[model samples]
Target chain A: MLGALKRLWHKLGSPRWFFALTSFWVSLFGWAALLFLLVGVVWGLAFAPADYQQGNSFRIMYVHVPAAMLAQSLYIGMGVAGFIGLVWRMKLTDVFIAASLPLGMAVTALALFSGSVWGRPTWGSWWEWDGRTVSTLVLFFLYVGIYALREAIAEMQLRARASALLAMVGTVNIPIIKYSVEWWNTLHQPASFGLTQKPAMPSEMWLPLLVMVLGFYALAGCVVLTRMRAEILHREGSARWVGEWVAGRRGS
Target chain B: MYFDSFTEFLQMGKHGLYVWLAYGSTALVLLWTWLSAQQSLASVTRRVEQQAQLAARNTQLAARNTMSGGAATGSEREQNLAGYDESET
Candidate 1:
């Protein structure tokens, strides 16, 4: 099984094959994203019961939780891709890193923004130096740092290698960000929702949140796949298959 | 449906501004990201197509130049040199 998975991974390293393989998954998740996000947001905003303690402000959870979760998960993804790129020397892994950086940064920024917004109504303040918030802020900057590293280098391969290295080094912070809330006293509540165990919130509330989380992941995947496709085409522009692919697009 | 009326729904009890602002900003950012990704892909496609066409044209021109020596027909040279512009990459 391990050997088979390795073979599949190597096969997927080919730019043309990767592009073709991801096309169907991209479209599938694209539609699923639309369906799940629409349903989840509408349901959470309207149908779910409001929080007894925090009232309607808790509605922010539908977006905040998912964005925060995706922020960390995407960072971890970048780290893993970086390791693969550095170790296996997979060019596809570099493409994955480039494609994910912008999306990850956007989601992280959104998480911070939503968290701050949620803070105002509930905590009566807009900002705090709590461990969770500060660590996440650092995570956001780490993403920015990687992006800046990419732009500062002129050569493509060098830029990718440098950024990939930075991504790997930054993996150390993910755990700190994840555990900050529990390790320190903060106004931010613990995760009330979990997939592996019983949820702290009632079914109706956590259910929509669960949908929103899945929707966010699906949406993130679609965006990354779209960007990765473009990166693959650009990098493999000299390949005959790419020329044919471009010609096909022109015909379509 | 949880609320009594549309106004209350829009208001979101007392936290409407916070709720709407959070959702609105996130939606706007995500939409912009998606649109820009599509635009980036389109731009890359356009660039790749242009480069491929230019390369093919250059190859064709080079071949034609080699086929015809310095002593060439007026019409052929004129045709060959007519508005011929290409970036040497």
Candidate 2:
């Protein structure tokens, strides 16, 4: 099993293979995001019914839910990259870690800020010291620290190893952030938007939420793909392929 | 189907500000990420090509100078110098 897994990793981890995969993902996600965003925004904003409880305030769920989900996914992704880079010593894995940092940070910041925005009207306060909120805030800071640490280092290998260590340590907070609401008596409500739990709100509410979620994932992919390609060029700048590709682009 | 009109639905009982802003920011962030990535790629490529071209130029110039100057004759010079030594049998 381990041998097969190793073979698969080696095959997939190659630059050409990885680049091909990213290209497919970027194209698919880009188109999917556009389609979903259009349908979601048009249907949701224009056709969905307003919530009885929160009135118009509930509409914020469209953006709020997706951002929050992406935030969680991004942290896990960073941790995964860090693990792969540290374990396999794949330069591409390190590239992924470096590239993923900004995207993860962006998502984290969006989640934290949007949650604050939503909390203002719903909870009647702009800030809360609840477990979930605090943990998520820490998650954002983790991303920031990784970002800064990567830039602070001069050597690429040293930077990758160092950031991977930080990423491993910080990943411990992810589950803590997710379960904080359940584990502690927090002011924030439990998960409203997930696979298992049905949305407490109406279909009109959830349909748009679904659209937004799909759109957000697509958008995240596009962002990641773009960054990954750039990272490829940066790391492999001296490589024959990168030189040829960049020359083609410049010539065109 | 449930909505009377699409425009009316989007209004969300006048909570459009928050919804639109949220959505807008998502779009913005995605764009920013893509553009930034492209920018870095361009710079990296440029730097690498510059270094490669410089190295190639240096190697070519060195080769030309060596060819024009001819090969080193250190061994031949040493043999000649040995023969001239007065004490050598």
Candidate 3:
């Protein structure tokens, strides 16, 4: 099983094969993302019971929590992909990094913006230099730095190597962002949902939140795949197979 | 469904502005991200197609010039080469 998994991993190094494989999966997940987001948003916004403490304002959790989770996860993903790309010189891995940056940046901004918006009423302030908020803000800057680094370097190989190294080093922030609430006192609340323990909120509330989390992930996936497909085509456009593929697409 | 009517739902029991702003801004940002990415992809793809067509035309022109064996003029060939250089830049 390990060898089979390794073989599959190696096979994915081929851009043509990877692009073909992702096309079908992208479509499948695209629909799933739409359904999950629609159901989760509707359920959480309307049907779920109001928060006794925060009242209806708590509904923001459905969007905010999921966006925050996605931001963190996407950063870690960039770290892993950067590691692979740097070590193995896998071009596809760089493609993953390039495709993820814009999405990650947008989502991180969403998390911060929404978090502060949630904070305004609860904490009576929009901005706080607390552990979680500060670390997350740092995470956002790291993304900006990665993109800027990529743009500054003209050579593809040097750009890839530099950005990948930066991504690997920047991963130190992910842990800080994750543990910030526990590590220090912060206006930001500790995670209410966890895998090892029962959720703090009631099932109705948490359940929709669960759906929203999955939906946001799927949505992120769809966005990445869509962008990745374009990146792949642009990078591989000169190849003979790409010409055939483009011609075929045009013909169809 | 939780609210008595659409008005109360919109009102969100005094927290309406905060909740709506959060969700609304998030939606707008997400939509903006998707649209911008899609637009970038479409523009890049179109550029790639145009570049490919230009390259093909260049190759065809070169082939035709070679086959005709000096039938094509020097000025025309230079102009074609110049176009190639412009495309590269």
Candidate order (lDDT): 1, 3, 2
lDDT of 1 by residue, A123-207 (tens): 8999989888998999999999999998899898898789889999999999888788799887778878766889987899998
Docking class of 1: medium
lDDT of 2 by residue, A200-239 (tens): 7767678888988898888778777767777776666567
Q: Considering every candidate listed, which one attains the maximal lDDT?
A: 1
Ordered by DockQ, highest first, the candidates read 1, 3, 2
Give candidate 2 regions above 4 Å deviation: A1-7, A246-252, B1-17, B45-89
TM of each candidate vs. truth? 0.93, 0.80, 0.93
In model 1, the runs with Cα more than 4 Å from the true position are: A1-6, B67-89
Candidate 2 C-alpha lDDT tens digits along B33-81: 7677667766665666665555455456557658879643667445444
Give lDDT: candidate 2, residue A123: 85
Clashing pairs in 3: none
**Cα deviation of B67, candidate 2, in Å:** 8.9
- Collision pairs in model 2: A45-B10, A46-B6, A46-B9, A46-B10
Give the per-residue lDDT of model 1 (tens digit) for B1-89.
Answer: 78999999999989999999999998998887788788888888887887777666657766776787544467755644542443223
lDDT of each: 0.88, 0.75, 0.87
Task: Point out the higher-scoring one by DockQ: 1 or 2.
Answer: 1
Judge candidate 2 against the unseen true structure and give its global Cα lDDT, from 0 to 1.
0.75
